[model samples]
Target: SVDLWKEAAMLVPEYFENTIDIWEECDVHWSPDLEFDQAADPAGAYADLSSDMTKSNSYRSWRKQLRDFIYRDVTLPLWQDETSDLYSTPEETESGFRMRVVQAIREQNDLEVEKLKAKFKSKFESQRDRVLRAEEKVKREEAQYKEKSYMSLVSIGSSILGALMGRKIASQTNVSKGATAIRSASRAAAEKADIQLAEDKLEQEQAKLKELEIEFDAEVEKLEQRIAPDSIKLEEYPIRPRKSDINVADVALLWMPFAIHANGAKEALFTINE
Candidate 1:
């Protein structure tokens, strides 16, 4: 008795018959319990064998003949209705569709980049203006502080010189220390204290300005990072395939039958149509 084995069916596209031309081999498996009566020792026969069809010349010739029949004799039906959505037009070739997809992607990327650049420009200008204003304020304050400090020092020096002169004149005239002399000395000491306080305040103001400058630089650096070319990636935007880009005519499950003999001889029973 000849035992029939069912193999998994292969899915073939009714369209693009040329795509199937690359098949060079086929796998044929025999059942473990099947006995080869033609073998000298039937018990030791190839009960479970997975054979490559191209390994034998007979199998190769048989596969070639079947392939020739498929190419020459087989007739695959296509959709005949002109209004069917499954039918592809001449202008809708794969290459043309690919070019259109690329163009669409490029346009989208350019638009996104322009929007990003505009946003970055606005932020950068705002930050730059803030820094400029802070710089101007600091400069103005420095100039004012320098002028005020110069006048204060001059006045303090003049007051101290007048107090010394008064003391010297009093000593020369043999006059005892009086309230007028004490008042002049007190005023001069107060002026010196005021100068020291002013210098301390100036140092504090300078330090605050330095901190502001550092903060401004950090803000600029952050803005620069946002506008960097590498920061934007095209892969972040994924373009999905459009429905019109894909057209499926038909799907088929084809079963092919093959027989392997005890001496490694193989045969295909029918053409692809079977």
Candidate 2:
């Protein structure tokens, strides 16, 4: 059986009145520890009702319902007023001045973050454009080089064929001399060298393109790291309270087995079948 309770109707109004009174008339600035102590004090309506001394689970259920109401109706309004006057207190204590200075520092940090984001965006775009342009130029040059190499190979083959034909014609006409044969052989060697030189040049260009590709990737990785969400650290002033910090331990036995015999009968039936 689950028991329900409405503590908000019974207790929240009075608690809220006390909280408002404390906020208005109280000159003492409540620290996080003091705030926590007051919230969890057994004298508090919800805390008292939800204490271990309570026999009904209704008290535990009441605690849950009252928590949100108390915070919304009481805590938030008080905190908002406190935060507005946090740095403007007439008494300039060491902690008060420090908080003011911290606020200024955080504002400056916000500006710095904005500047860094803009700078990173500009640099990333410029670098990306440069890399893309360089890649495009390399592609264009590679295509031109390939076409030039094809033409050069064709020219070399034509020259070698023409030389061989001339040598054959001279031999048929009985006009071929040792000098002619040597000149023809020298021309063939020159053509072969030209082809080898074109091949070497092509290889060098390919290597250069590979190096550029590696450099482009490295630069891109560097830019990504600089612009990544984890890379930027924004300054946080004072610590914000976590949900766990606000949690008050529940003391009620919320679940009660009103029909324990039904569960026992099901278990016994399974045991008999086994």
Candidate 3:
């Protein structure tokens, strides 16, 4: 599409060059940027200029030549109607279409990004709650593990003392006390293993929560980049002033000269009152 537009745009300058040649040959002169001459008589000067332009011999010669050229060489083959426009006028065309296109694309991307952000936000929030709960559970388990470990150490010390006292007494009652201490030591060791298992499980859950949070943040950043406004071209087309309502000065200075010199050369079949 861009290549096609470039090719078309290239033809515009070629057409303008041909028109310029005709304009120069006819001694047609004007400028879109021509400022009002402050030193010249503003009132009568315009009238004199208008009369001189319409009465020029060069203007007459070009008008006849160009009419002949268009009817014979250009318009004859197409056989178009007199009312049909040969070329588009600048005023009739729309500007800023490219900017509008860019805006539309940006808007679509923004909407998609918002949707993704909402989805990720919801997921992140849910996972955050889970992480918080897991952290709290881990804290409780750690405290419980500390208490069980301490009890296990005390049980082992008691078993050692009972065994020593039984050996010294050489009696049945001291032996019974030693056996009870051994049973207590075994239960404490089992509780210690359970506590260790709980701590390991807590560590695994915490690691998973950390990983999930990192993943969520990374995805959110990706979505943000996808919707960044800098991704689209924002250059705008230049705007021209509207000329729908023609004033008297415009007719005398700009419109009349242009129509007489350019459009008049074509020997238009119909008059352009508007």
How many residue pairs clash per model?
A: 0, 0, 0
Question: How well is each residue in 59-171 modelled by candidate 2, as lDDT tens digits?
Answer: 55545644543344332111111322333223345444545545654565556656666656665565556556655655655566566556655565555566577776345
Encode model 1's per-residue lDDT on 1-274: one tens digit a residue: 1122222222322223223442223222222232222323333333332243224644454446444533443322222121112232332454443444444444555666566666566655655565565556556555655665565556556555665777664453323334444455565555556556555655665565566556656655554444333442222111222333222222222333446689988675444322
Please provide TM-scores, in order, for all candidate models, with all chains considered together. 0.32, 0.27, 0.41
Candidate 3: lDDT of 144? 65
Scored by CA lDDT, what does every candidate get?
Answer: 0.44, 0.42, 0.45
**Maximum-lDDT candidate:** 3
Residue 117, candidate 2: Cα error in Å is 2.6
Model 3 misses residue 207 by how many Å? 3.4
How much is the lDDT of residue 86 in candidate 3?
A: 26
Candidate 3 stretches with Cα past 4 Å from truth are: 1-114, 163-183, 186-192, 227-230, 233-274
lDDT of 2: 0.42
Error of 1 at 193 (Å): 17
Deviation from native of the Cα of residue 227 in model 1, angstroms: 17
Q: Name every residue pair that clashes in candidate 2.
A: none
Q: What lDDT score is found at residue 21 in candidate 2?
A: 30
The order by descending TM-score is 3, 1, 2
Clashing pairs in 1: none
